[model samples]
Target chain A: MLDMPFIRIIEGLNHTLENVIAPEVESTLAKGQLFAVVEILKQISGRFDHKHELIVEDIQVSQQMLTTLIETFTAAAIDIPDEFQANTETIDATAMSGEQLRQQRDRLEIIVSAALDLLNSHRAEIVDAQKVEHTVFMQLGKNLFRNMLLVSQHRFDKISQLDKED
Target chain B: MALADNSRLASYLAEKLGGSELSISKEWQNTEGWSMETFSLDVEYTKGGNKIEQAIILRRQPVSGLLEPYDVSIEYRILSALQASKVIVPETFWYEADPAVLERPFYVMEKVPGDVHFVTQNSDPDYRLIADDDERASLAEDFIDNLVHIHQSDWKSLGLDFLGDPGPGKNSALQQIDYWSDVIERAGVRAKPLVTLAVNWLRTNAPETDQVRLVHGDYRTGNFIYQHSHITSILDWEMTHLGDPHEDLVYVLGALWRSPAPTDWVCHLLSEEDFLSKYEQRSGISVDRDKLNYFQLLLDLKAVGIMATAANAFAQNKTEDLKPAAFGSILDLAYAALAQHLNERLSSC
Candidate 1:
């Protein structure tokens, strides 16, 4: 699940271009280009969605990390909160839609984050805390590498050009 | 608060400057800035029977942006206080806080003459930011000297105590962590485990600083203006505050502003060794590698906070500008970098 849906992004782009930016265009070529962009976005509005496999991969990694975290806490005699364990157990990604899987991933990541915070607070009590932290970091590293593949290169130069003209 | 047109601005300037036949010759809002709304106004007027022309910069608080709870007055106050210091800054004219004037708090200052250079990953390697080696060296010296002046200036004497000193010891580091943490919470973005892990690591490993000096929070190459190999003005004081000097140093050495590959100069001006040594020698403050490491993580956290805030602004429909939306969309990129760094650092520790 994307934070802002792909449809909403397209709609926003079209709305801003047509209503806000188009009226301000003075050059005919720029105006035509802007309208062409709006038209193209409209055409492809429903043809695509964020990759489902990426969300599934994120969920799997998070689940594995949480499982290891629960085991580490169990071995250390640290009380794992029932809420945390319940969130960990609710990772049912199978047969779920992309949106559902994304929500699951987001929810599980929040729980995992809280669990890490809990671990930090109890670091003095846990045996080999560094080893446990290192384990979580490595798992997070995997997720990060996968997530980065989805990020697009920033077009700051293009943005700067628009700014100069505006 | 909608002072949207040039005519309204011209009228306001006429009233403020006590000039007659005033008109805005040229005016444009600086769309490159993501935080505050910056507008350049070239005005022609008559005062005391003499024709006057001036280029003035007006910075107004934005409705929502990367740094929110917007207040243009703090920047105005900082620039106002720094007028007599050795630091090169634009001349402040007046600050108008009443909403009746511009529909938001705004300030006007002399539009310093220069070009603000931008260095991108795709920029040519040989001529990334400054082409001439001598010009680059000159700019590097001015950059280091200005930073030293900023860190060495007495905040209290300069009446910059309003920025709230983050007192001695580890308070500087801890204060910044808390500050940026609050920004993240306010942005209300989804939790990423990496951010939490890094925050925890930062808190657990925060170093101490006996001296608290003025830190230009966003100091780097792009934030300044250069003319003929000289830095005419150091801009963007919105993030200025009192903190450990190392915070600014770490920020200057961030990878975001460096020249691409073949020449990995810090801020595309000088090497890391040169920056640190010059800063240390000039300010008489010893550079701490451990503190630099800690602040590096903190800097990453700060970037995450800014991006999250930008994303939140767009997500909430606070503004129609798509820049925030684009910035928000790239939050994952920052997370990936932060996660990789944390993995390396935590494993070594």
Candidate 2:
């Protein structure tokens, strides 16, 4: 078991761009939009009350952004492993064609974007805390925190090995 | 003082203790490494079965060093002078500049204990969390206030005027920029494009120089030690030199110190604006925003160049710590930031 103390969040925002009625086709261009979204989240909000909200929002939005990014990445015609999916054997035996993969990537991009907007809407209501579902932020922050821990641990392992060897 | 095993230092200290029979106890010191490497030392001397215990630091020069090499006498003299000028510092105990004693110049000073925040872009959860917003703001304000006091300090009669004369050229800021740029160019392989661009921009837009002030070369969050909500000591001063009055300000507001943002004040508890205001009120010298921006960019450049130089040395196997491959990654990450900062500054200019 481990404990890493978190710092105070100074500025937090729920910056969202809604394009549900008008979808973005160029997922490659959408990647740039995701970067802006991350930048906006990087702002540190108040440390005492809304910080937990921001932390949770950061994780959900980050994951949602990554999901969109991966879709666009694959839409640009990337070969991905079936293991990335749940129950890979259960998926259709019909191998996805290049065009089909691109479409899947594009459509999945919309789903991810929706997920991000969902988080944004949840965050938007925070000016008045009574409006937001109490359990929502906690659930999202917890999930995102878990994923971040995994990624950080992976990088740290590589760093330790490199440090020891060099 | 606690000794890192395999250090041939204890016997060396005992043999040099003159006629007094000596017993040594050691403790760890986690601070400055410029003038002298410090370690806590407790010595007991017995003459005719009567013993007296004394506590001090074992200060020695590093054989293969990282920072600029300094003369031992300068530190001894400066601190001795500051003690008289009302600057809080450890009382100097002993100084041995002869290499024959410890194979390097060394000195011992009084040891003070306190909590240190180096701000590694990481958090420490142990201390009571500042559960309130207003308290964090107050802490940030105090930290900046200290810097104001430091800048407002009188070194006129302090005898610290003996350190270094301002280099050639009446404009100290340009002179400093030229000097650091030259150092960067000579210290690396191919010039880093971003740093090179920043250097050129600084040369083009020189800030009007002010009266020379004592610049603590490495004044950042990590340098100060604190205890019970009070700053105990400002640790590193090896890079202390006479130069631009804005040098210290830029360092405090530099990208490294602004790791999280200029807002998340560490060690001290105030926003960047709060700190600057405190400085203005105390020192009566309005901090020029233009010069501050230029110097802030310079600070980012200087930091990257210094880090690059270290990584390069480690890569070439010229340094003791052999982790260049790992440390190089840090330089690479910072390089992007340096590039962005350079572009932003240039475009603004």
- Top DockQ model: 1
Question: By how many angstroms RMSD does model 1 differ from the true structure?
Answer: 2.4
- Candidate 1, DockQ to 2 decimals? 0.58
DockQ (CA atoms), all models: 0.58, 0.01
Candidate 1 structure quality by residue, lDDT tens digits, B1-349? 2246767878889989899889988887776677788889889999999999999999988888888878899999999999989999999999999888778889999999988876566556665667789999999999999999999999999999999988898889899999998998888753677777888888888888898999999999889999999999999998998999888999998888888767889999989998899889999999999888778888888888999898888777787777777788888887876776677678778
- By summed lDDT, the worst window of 10 consecutive residues in model 1 chain B runs over B119-128
Candidate 2, residues B50-95, lDDT tens digits: the string is: 6766676666665333342346666676666667643455677667
Question: Model 1: how far is A56 from its true place, Å?
Answer: 1.4
Off by over 4 Å in 1: A27-47, A90-94, A162-166, B1-3, B123-125
Q: In model 2, what is the error at residue B56, expressed in angstroms? A: 2.4
DockQ, candidate 2, comes to: 0.01
* Model 2 bad stretches (over 4 Å): A1-166, B1-19, B27-36, B46-52, B69-77, B122-142, B167-170, B258-263, B266-268, B323-329
Candidate 1 chain A vs. true chain A: TM-score? 0.82
For each candidate, what TM-score against the reference? 0.94, 0.59
Q: Each candidate's iRMS in angstroms? A: 2.2, 20.1
